[model samples]
Target chain A: MSDPADPEAAPLSATHPDQPRDFVAPGADRDFAGERLTVDPAGARALLDARLIAAHAAGDTARLVTLYAEAGDSSEAAGDAAAAAFYRTHAYVFALQSGDSRAEELHRWLLREGREE
Target chain B: MTVTDSDLAAVSAPVEQARGLPNACYTDPAHFAREADAVFFASWAGLAFAADAPEPGDVKPVRFLGQPLLLARDREGVLRVFLNVCRHRGMILVEEAARLPRAIRCPYHSWCYELDGRLRTTPHVGGPGTNRHAAIDRAQLGLVEVRSHVWMGVVWVNLDGKAPEFETYAADLRARWAAFDRPLAFAPDGAFELEVACNWKLAVENYCESYHLPWVHPGLNSYSRLEDHYNIEAPGTHSGQGTRAYRPMLAEDGRRFPVIAGLDAQWEEGAEYVALYPNVLLGVHKDHAFAILLCPQGPERTVERIAIGYFDTAVLGEDWAPMRARNAAMWKEVFEEDIFVVEGMQKGRHAGGFDGGRFSPVMDSPTHCFHAWVAERLRQPA
Candidate 1:
């Protein structure tokens, strides 16, 4: 398996190889400019936790989809199937609600992992 | 039922011979419980206004008749009703009025549901972070939807789901008022509520006739006299009084609200107010209309909510604010004046010797009409 915390680890569709592979990379702690920050993966997750709270408080469903999906990808790269499924479930729900097209991708990922029916 | 069979027989008698509902029907909790099941649950009852959940994603939780119910407008803008309890642990879902950008997330366990009541996900039903479980069938568990129908801004619910469709049930009332069925624009400031210490039925009885107008609403009687009104009774459906002397409120600048287009000559100077049995009271005029939803808080308390709307959408503009405020205030004062009478009647119910009083055959037919309707509903086989 690839290094879980490596910035170039596989894309979120690695579990379902038939899907698009140009998606955002899992476990990649990068800033908004696509520059990899030197922050530890745990530190990066804590930052996401704060961002998630702000996003929810603002009722920003679009941002919620992106953040939860990124959290799921990071968990997936770490081989934490349960955590990955949990975050992906949220991503799927928010995406479905906001009419975001990414819901299709998140649902397929959850289905491939045997987490969603 | 706390009401005696003999008491109901007198209430069900002809208008000339009938007496009002028994005192126990209003003063006894056990009778209120029976009335809740027979009159409210078994028939279509007004629960809230569609305006309460006007936007898509708007959710309003209502505690009605001891049942926690939720009113939600789905993503498609269709309003729906559900038992507010969660399908998992029976927790209350939406605790207050809110506009959800996405799904309804249960605060206790993070169970998510789509805006249309589909159970979307259970966060960790199978153990730490695992969502799926063989025992939890998402398909079998959506919010319990109550049968609801929206008409003329009022959201009517059939709690027991045994009543006929709203259109069929209200056909007589609908056909009678078909002329004013054009687009109705709600007044931006024409909503107010009053809490009175009286049984909900008293409010309905009071609103049914013009007989009390000269004494209770002298201001309204100054222009719309009692002689200018006539009885409106559709027996098992609705009953009230219609005034042939309705005059619209005028602004300080002599401007009056725009008249409804294509009205018949009869409505040019006329208006009608009817108690839509069970809980909704409505009044329609040439230029404006109002709906009053009577919410029974307890056997001895009721909440009366009133909202007015206009025939022209221009009334919703900022320039119309002052005129709208004046209109709302006029109705508010008249409704407030009736508070003493209803509360007085409620106190009268505790008089152990009062035999429900007698109806003035000429002037009290509308009130008697309502009493007969209640009696017939209660007499239905349980």
Candidate 2:
């Protein structure tokens, strides 16, 4: 997947089909830039998005955290601060699940808006 | 087989004239079901010991009164109880006790909850890796917290959320034993449980009065004579017996554990036992106190969770461990000794013609008081 022009867009490491998040079509991982990720031969990117939606619907917090973090970028790129904060807050939940630095970014963002609970 | 109006009428009479509760109150399925809600749920029941979840992020799941409950300590080190069922799919959440680092994650769906019971994450609810949906409101749903209070080293819960404040329900007994009002740190050694083959009510009845002590606990009778004990009755609250000759466990070197400060000279060798109505047996002494949280598993099974606490936590260092062990062993023996009679009384309740038996006006006042309290609570509109 090609990285988005906006510096604020989510990191594209996992966006590539070769990344671990995608196990559907091993070699096609690099084809997932935006919509092509959806319209590919197997629509791996689209399937991944759909799977993420399904996971959220099923109350899968582990999957939801990354999905929400990714959603924050889209919401921010679309100029929806409230929506971005909400998605970031949701991602921050999974961030708290680990001691790693992933949650720090979400924490700082939410903390700036006085939304850190 | 539920409690009929006639059953309620039997325990309503004055102590001198009243009979004990009928067999149906203890044996009937209908009455037990009613009690699951009205008696046990509506009233303040002793649920667990505070020491069970002593630190922040410690989560313990408790199945109380047939309801799944979670005892959790939050990030800020505050402890609270919540319904263990998840709000999303009604799944049972924390099933075991562990030090949960950040949040309680539901195994069925990974719906995460803050230690304080807030529903913090709903994962993919929005759409493909989307955790947002306009209809999904995080504020609208969180884990349901059960009403609870910690007192005297025990955790007490009001399932129906209508019982009076703990201070109000226990004011009388607290005032009577005001001398031992200081903080009580439970000694680790003095913890044990007894599974009694008797109805829960039978255990409570046996504990409320000292009328059977001379016969049931002959060892205790040697030092604490029957006449040295008096009945303690607080209508609608607590009732039991008190003794002036409380025996303290002495080490081989003739050393006794430190006594609680501010205890009156009268407490030099005195102790009191009180049955906090519904289901909790409490004992207070000059140096230590105990709460026996009776878990009523069924009509004929009661598990006594007993914990003994000292006046101060600092007093429980390794040096006092031996004394604590002796104290625990002594109490365990005393409690085990009373088992037969309580189980026997439960067996006797099954007799076809036992008309709720009768109470000895002179010696059974405390038991009668408990009967009255249970009768009064059971009679209320459910």
Candidate 3:
């Protein structure tokens, strides 16, 4: 199955059209203005997944809410509807688990947007 | 009771005429306890740097004013301050300084707390009639939170729970450094910590003026002249000295660290050493940054932790150990020269006749400002 959420599937820079772009790991130092830089998709995804898994294993709903929200944003930005939906569900569950009103509102917004589509 | 204008005027008068707070203020254990309540506990005190606990779940345990404090970043990446005691059986939660944990577990009872200070487990304390124990109100029992704020990478905590808002207390510093916010990074090479055998305030006083630089730090005085130094007095709150000559620790090719986005090349010629109210001292130069946190251990003892962080993380990848070593050497030379003066002042405070030694009305404004702040806080009703 071709995953649209693959980081390599998208151009490094959407805003900077003229810049020659490249991907660099988190700790690498490259000229930000001269080149388009995209974080390694697998590594970024792994970080998000690991944080969520750890939070879930630890029963840390607050952490899960934050990680799921970040993952959902990345997935949506990459145009991966399925992955985005999955992350949104986790965000909703973690939001309810945390009893955070702001997270609850975010969950509602995600659901409303999903229903509208 | 509020301190009157006359009271302030009296305290701010030339140190000689002012009749400094009794010798007890610096020596007596009873007075130190009072200060814990009046100053360290009541007002905002700088605790640790934000960089120490940058990521979510990062935690740093600190001891300040005889209280164990846990500085942690929550799962949401929000920095939170809590007493380092477990809710169950009152054991110290974290003993080391490092990144955040999956849970803060008590060593004695294995009771766990979430990074946000929520009680997550009581560990087999719930069975039969114990499931709803009246003695343990889980809802009301979370980590005791201390009001905390971050500015310029320094974390300031209000222990009394009644301090004025952080914005209000640090308004002066925020306004002063508002321009160079983006490019400012803690220079890992320039940062340092020291243990001074004197009251923390004495260290602040020594740093607030350049009167001793010529005689004490002759190496620094070679390029940074005493006359080129200026006093930064944020009346009754914070004070420090500024210097004009700030040389960057350059790489092998003479390349300097990346400057902040909008700063001019002349920033090196415009260095500022700001003492953030109680303890933190920051030296912001165009090429690098250095900060020190002076923690008071006792009336006669203090530990000053200094860190020289850089604006560019890329510098760490370079053969920059030499730069770190040189910067540390230079600061060590300068601070070592300060020991005598601080220790001298501590010992002088014990004299029966030395009623707050004289201050040079011209060059001592910064020290006067610090004295004024100490006097003001000391006079406030506890």
lDDT scores of the candidates, listed in order: 0.85, 0.79, 0.69
Give model 1's clash tally: 0
Candidate 1 per-residue lDDT over residues B248-332, each given as its tens digit? 8899999998897778999999999999998999999998899999999899999999999888989899988999999999999
lDDT of 3 at A41: 74
Distance from true location, Cα of B70 in model 1, Å = 1.2
Better of 1 and 3 by DockQ: 1
Q: TM-scores across all candidates?
A: 0.89, 0.82, 0.71
Where does the lowest 10-residue lDDT sum fall in candidate 1 chain B?
Answer: B122-131
What is every candidate's C-alpha DockQ against the true complex, given to 2 decimals?
0.37, 0.14, 0.02
Better of 2 and 3 by TM-score: 2
CA lDDT of B205 in candidate 3?
A: 80
| Residue B260 accuracy (lDDT) in model 2 | 80
Q: CA lDDT of B270 in candidate 2?
A: 84
Q: What is the lDDT of residue B320 in candidate 3?
A: 68
